[model samples]
Target: MAGTTGIIGGGIVGIALARALSARGEHVTVLEKEARLAQHQTGHNSGVVHAGLYYKPGSLKATLCAAGRVSIREFCEEKGLPYREVGKLVVAVDESELGALAEIERRSAENGVPDLARIDDPSRLREIEPHVAGVAAVHSPRTAVVDYASITEAMAQDVRMAGGSVRLGHEVTGIRSKNGRVHVTTPGSESVFDRLVVCAGLQSDVVARFVGVDASPKILPFRGEYWELAPERTDLVQGMIYPVPDPRFPFLGVHFTRGVYDNVHVGPNAVPALAREGYRWLSISPKDTWESLRWPGAWPLAKQHWRMGVDEISGSLFKPLYFQKARRFIPELKSSDLARKSGAGVRAQAWGRAGELLDDFAVDQVGPVTLLRNAPSPAATSSIAIAEYIIEHYLVKAAA
Candidate 1:
């Protein structure tokens, strides 16, 4: 624990781990590919701090998110950053979705989601969201919002204050274990460390392969597109408004969200990205596309979800179709009410050679190199807890 530790990827999880390791008196250095931190998912997300509503009980997401929700609030308060408990309502627009809504309520209860309640009364649902229409809903009063990029930067500040180093523009080109140490090669320099932790979000699979890890469970990018609400119409959504998620998939359906600054936006229809970092339809990388196409899992995975994929792509292309889906929840939403398309985020979803999507957080140590293979949605919310977990479970044992 007293030796030099190197972490790849400057996203929230990596920075949080660097801070935690530095706090424990280890010499820590963080390497970021871009010139800044949180350049990817951390910066582009809806900024909603999940309240452990959907994850299965006893899963890494459930345990970490439950603890993370409290820790993030405390950390934000201590740092004087903006954190708001604006609440969220997962509404079922019709009787068909009522079953999914009830299951979500059950999962929330199992996960010990704070102040979670089933609102079956139409009048009460109206009280919570006047313009929203739903036969039933599960309300989480503690579901909050925060700027994740700000939190990542603050964590970097904490690392620097603790005498740790943050090296920007240090794109990790290679990773190898020599003797008992790990060597991380950047563009023009190489650094040797007692241990290495890879938190590469979008490039996780490639980074893992650099350390001689398997190629299955490859990283697949799913772009989530959003639309901001008109300034005057922002008043329509008081907090977060969501639809009951499909149990077959990990993505939560398109919904409305109120940011920490009180700006409301809707969307995030999921469509496959041409590149790992592709945030738009036109952003394409031939190398990345070839890699995905050649991967064994891509074809079967596409076959299984082809219909949903087509529907999502159609929704992404046509604004009227997109608005139609959202109108199920907010009946009054009009095409004129939606402003220009705003920010977008690509999820680093992991798909196995078996053609299955990984549901939980995946991390495994190959000697001195630790790879964060799959970390999606609740990752930002659970970053602090995940940092503690890595240090206590992996790094501690490695040092010992």
Candidate 2:
């Protein structure tokens, strides 16, 4: 079939992009490797609609995240989807981290986050979350919680309603550009499109290579493992709670999050994954393992942050250690309070050849193909804005 635009990967970004193009009366087709949409990172996130916190000022993440929060809420309301403005707290447990907390507050303000207030008194903290302990914190009223899977599903519905086709289990093996048309080859057949947008999250590098792009900044999958709080201890957390993140690391610290269903979950320790889709310890892929091990960016990242890696791996294996990290915020936490393993999500973290983590979202255009390389954390919250950006910068400008 012929389409004006072909979107690879049916995660949040791909679905949103397809919907946006189709809404504009363009013929769009989405190719998804999995039978269902959002089967990867989109489905496995904490579902927090961030309030533009923790991102560097004047960066794409800050701009998209700030605008995406509003767009997501409006989209959810229009679609009658479930979402909540439960708010969030970034707590500083020790005096040493107060400066970091202040920096986060400054960044949030620069990003245009509204209704932010500082809470330093223990009494007010108790009123918000009686179980949480912190010497200082920043209260962001705009932080929200939502079901990302539902949002992606709604985007898919909109795509179909706009006369676009979503092809499931159609994985592209190769891509070539010729005569102003791009040809995409899958195992079953070949498809053609005027323009191609590659939103493959974990496999973005591989997808870019097929179209003859350099595919720099290889994706290093970092598995974030989570644990659910026991049902009896759900009241310990009133809303979303987070620890002040270390500036050196990209992953947010283990924090408390209340899902839209009112169930509280704790965790998401960042550890290197053995496979791109490895959700459990026993899950391993030799091809993925070898590729990751031999990547030019892997060893330098390890050398620079070996201590943090060791700590994350230790926390992943030891329940007590995991509880200790959580206890910094909620002093009442106990090892027994943690329930059995729930599930894990692998973050598609991008590492440059120089061993530095890419702090902002990365997109590249070569000829007629556009590859969205690194889109992690805020991508879910920033889907709508990202879609518009892609349409403007990649589709329209590239065509011009």
Candidate 3:
């Protein structure tokens, strides 16, 4: 395709953008490095459509998550996909974390999240989750779960239906803008477009540089490893079981998520990955490793959180340590209860040179190219709204 709005990356964000543009009668082409769509972060996420609980009120995450929850549900229903509004419980294991839980409720309410209730009665807590032990909890009934991979697939189909083309295994190697046109060179071929929108997840910064943007905020891959509960222990989780997360960190702590298929998943410890696509302990790519380690953003982050980093690395190496984190929520959970090891998902967490993690989704415009630098968690939940926002903010302005 020539002279189209080229979107780099075929994750949910890219697909949603293609679908939106195509629906508006704009020519769009999506270039995906992977052989299939949603193969990385979008496909491997915990699949929870977060209910704007943890984000600060009025932030992009809060606004988009609330709006995206509605959009995702509607899209799923219309497309005849499986989804469940099974709700979530943010439990406080001790008195110290009660304040954080209260803050979450406050933020949720301020963000217009409906059906939020505080569970304090032990009997009622037991009624909702038999094995969960907590002094108090915030019950968010709007927090739901679905298969994000399926949602992405459906979005790709919608894009194709709208006359957009999705090119798989087409790795974007270069991008440049000149003479009112953006040129994108892929592994197999070269294409030019009026404008380029990149949603290149783990490789976003590199793609941004190719288009001559500063791309200063580097993408740090944090491998979230999960463990499935044994068949017999699956009964321990009913809905989503979460611990009151640390306020300083972006990670939501190790929690229990009940999958759409009725199995319970316990884990996702945020450990730094040696490789950008590193899923296993031994999985490594030399380029990804060298780039990550040498980034200016990496050293300061390491200095600030070296202790936490060491702990996370230790947990990844030892089963007992990993299970111990889970035991904080469900005390009955044994090392043996951790059965199959689920595949790892790498989060593309962006950090600035000053060592501050980018808390909200970031979008930067360089000439005719709009690059999405940091769209981490809730990006999946907020994909559609983010697309709409991008269309209104960037594409329409470019057209004008």
Query: What lDDT does each candidate get?
Result: 0.90, 0.89, 0.88
lDDT of 2 by residue, 58-152 (tens): 99999999989999999999999988988898899989999999998898889888898889899998887789888989998789999999999
Sort all candidates by lDDT, best to worst: 1, 2, 3
Q: What are the clashing pairs of model 1?
A: none
TM-score of 3: 0.97
Q: Write the per-residue lDDT of candidate 3 for residues 1-400, one digit (tens) a residue.
A: 2357999999999998898888888899999999999999999889999988888788888898888989999999999998898789989988998888888878778998889999989788888888988899989887889999999999999889888899999999998778989889987799989999999999999888897778678898899999899989899899899888775574647879998888888878888888888999798888888987888878888898899998988887898888887888888878888998887899999988877898898899988899999999999999999999888888788777
**Model 1 ranges off by over 4 Å:** none
Better of 1 and 3 by lDDT: 1
lDDT of 3: 0.88
lDDT of model 3 at residue 264? 84
* Cand. 2 TM to true fold: 0.98
Ranking by TM-score: 1, 2, 3
Give the TM-score (vs. native) of candidate 1: 0.99
**For model 2, the run of ten residues with the poorest summed lDDT:** 246-255
Clashing pairs in 2: none
